[model samples]
Target: MGGLTTAAILSDLGRKVCVLEQHYTAGGFTHSYERAGYEWDVGVHYIGEVGAATRTRKMFDYLSNGQLEWAPMADEYDRFYVGDKVFNAVAGKDEFRNNLIRQFPNETQAIDLYMRLLDRTGDALSAFGMGRGMSKLQRFAMKPWTAWKLRGAFRRITYDVLSDLTDDQDLIATLCGQWGDMGMPPRRSPFMAHAMIARHYLYGGYYPVGGSWRMAETIIPKIQAAGGEVFTYAKVEKILVENGRVAGVEMKDGHRIRCDCIISSAGVDNTFSHLLPEDVAIKSGYRQRLTSVTPSMAHLGVYIGLKGTAEELGLPKTNFWIYPGNNYDKAVDAFMDNPDAPFPVVYISFPSAKDPDYENRHPGTATIEIVAPAPYERFEKWREETWGKRGDDYEALKEALGSRLMETLYDKLPHLRGKVDYYEVSTPLSTNWFGGYQRGELYGLEHSQQRLKQDWLRPKTTIPGLWLTGQDVLTAGVTGAMMAGLITTMSMVGARKMGPLLRRIYA
Candidate 1:
């Protein structure tokens, strides 16, 4: 997202830019993998807050030059199966809430309040969503409490918010079905976090045409046309610093590329702990906040390739938010401790179901991804000097989890039992080593309302000519990272031009 968004904005502003990626492919997790005939998305199971008529859609349209296409998910895009009851999530804004109220008739008021809060979260972004330059005065005013944010963090986002709204436990769990997106559980994650994600998709989530990679691919050409370049497998060994200021980047092959600024869509932990100097001087409360706050959750994803058509094999359109039993936190705990534990929280999605052409291209091919929150400690025992190395134990752990996922898939889709052609599991170890994220946390720092990394993770940093961006500044997922990219560009240019730029792009 950073690579694409940065290239677009910078190229538009007439600044020569080059995006470096470690993977042979771009888009990081957004890119899809093809094994035999199956294509699946490693990230972006579904994107919310991107209605066709909304500002996000307009932003996407201008960014991609209308080259991209979005497919609206069908009725009941997602289904939640807790215990014996299955809650169908239909598309259409009004339809979504009405169905929820129908399912939990007695808790109508609670459902209404939940939806309203979700809206508030989206509205709240207006305060921060614009590039920082738009509100330099506000940012300056709030700088002293950089360790803290929004003043009353818990009041804005806490268990108390939801608890006060609804007494219906099952209803609440259903409301939080997409918790994996936030990475942290409800108890630890803030209500503001939940509201931003939830409300964004309330009009219903969307699936990109082609695949998630198309999102990256479409923007690349736009960036190139705007005079930028994207180089792949070009690993940056370290950030070059001159007198505590960012000078450029030194690649693994010993080549150096100089630049005026740097923006890392890479996870925060990866940026600070790996790319930058290990003992670099800590300038402000920013580094302190990073040290003090806990990182977000990691994930274990099982990607399966099936030998049969999704319809014949019984696949659903929306994702399946499956919990073995309703002991949400306990189930997550068991799975984190014991990968072999029975009945863990599983989120299942089939990319081909979203784009049948993918299946048309690969007849009788279906792809499914089953993911669960995992702990960095499970494989932290192997975090030694071999930082970027892949190990034997790593593959073994992946296979164990993969087999379990296959079992779960077969149970859910019996016809697909023997029809599965291939499968693989991705763990935190793989994420940290390959993706360069520290401790395997998907999003950067956890947003707990308290200890927000307001100073450090933003565009401006303690060192001169140095800055930070990506998942840390705005949170994870495509939109959040893109917003970070916008800020990084704004920091270089004038902040006042941000709103006008949007108007220009649309014009």
Candidate 2:
């Protein structure tokens, strides 16, 4: 998404950009796969702030040339089931607040205060993005103002900040129900990360009109219109450097694409640990700086196909987040320690129900996706094995995990117990095999307080002519990567040129 966004925007600005995707298909996590007449999106489940004419929506419009459209989900977009209790988040801001107040009338004060904090955190995020686009001298000059702007929730831990507002652990869990969105529990995540995700979905959730692949399908034309090309299965072996600058990239087949300016949306870990030369990484201090951050939790995926349509099978557009208990951090620790323990979090998304044009695409078919945290260590032994030809033991382990996830689904909707036609399970190794993450890290780097404080993870790196842009540069989610692409463009072009470009896009 980050690579596509950057290429699309630069192409719009009359600069041709070529995007090389390692995978057979483009769009990274936004891409979809089909099996047994059923298709499912890997990463994109739902998006927020696109139902209206907001900045997010405007950017999508400009990139897709108004070909992309959105279909709103149910008013109660997120339904949380924490240990037997049921809670949900509604569409409008007031409706969400009132629904929370109705459930826990005594915590009205805390709920209102939390809402105000979200508003403040939104402002802090703007300042944070502005700082990323600034040059070293500009950032140094505005350090005092930027520090002051982010002193509140941006610098604090999520659990610590929420603990100050309320003593009800259940309320905290309910507020942090969507923690899986950022792939972190409340205790370890930064409050800014929590607030940004919470505020983003406050408006509601929406899905692409046809499918998630429509995102890349619509934007690819913009890049091609400017005489650029997007090539898939073009795996890059190493980044070439000459005289302390980027020369080009060497492909796995021993071919080289010699371009002076190289923008890598791969990732920080891959760039520093594997792609760049050891000498260059050490001299640039990225090797030492990499130790300060860790990869986010890996996951297991269960994709199910049903014989009937979504409406015929009675699937809701709302997403379901199931938890064993309210203490999310403690639950995660217990599950990580013992695989037999209850799942820390189980998120089920109804993709067929969310997309209005699903019937047109797949006719009489429905698809469901279930995601849960899975430690990469459990699958590390299979690192040397092939993707589909791993072993019998690997297949058995995946079958066991898939069965467990299916039972959880049946527990909620018992009527569909025997309705599933085909299903498959994917482990962390699958992520590494396809997405190229060494540890199968879901959201790139963890969204911890310390990781968020790192100022060096910006567009412009110490290596001249080499740039960075992705979820690692900013936050996770498709919108986050898109915004990071926008900031990278601003940093590449001066503010004078970007001023007119921004007005032209957002106007």
TM per prediction: 0.91, 0.99
- Angstrom error of the Cα, residue 197, model 2: value is 0.4
Q: Cα deviation in Å at residue 55, candidate 1?
A: 1.5
Worst 10 residues of 1 by lDDT: 146-155
lDDT of 2: 0.93
Number of the top lDDT candidate: 2
Q: Give the C-alpha lDDT of model 1.
A: 0.72
User: Backbone clash tally for model 1?
Assistant: 5
lDDT of 2 by residue, 134-176 (tens): 9999999999988888987778888999899899998999999
> What would the C-alpha RMSD of candidate 2 be, to one decimal place?
0.8
lDDT per residue, candidate 1, 1-507, as tens digits? Answer: 865686688788777778899877888877887876678888777776565556677778878878878776667777877777787677766788899999999998988877766555544565555434334576677555432433343335445577788777778777777677776556666776776767666777688888888888888887788677889898998888877778999999999999868866676666666677765634433445566667777778888888878777777778887777555667777776776676457788888788746665778777888887777788888866464355787767767777777777676667776777887787777677667777887776776666343544566666676666676777677777777777777776765666688677656
- How much does each candidate deviate from the true structure in C-alpha RMSD? 3.1, 0.8
Q: What lDDT does each candidate get? A: 0.72, 0.93
Tell how far residue 371 is off in model 1, in angstroms: 1.0
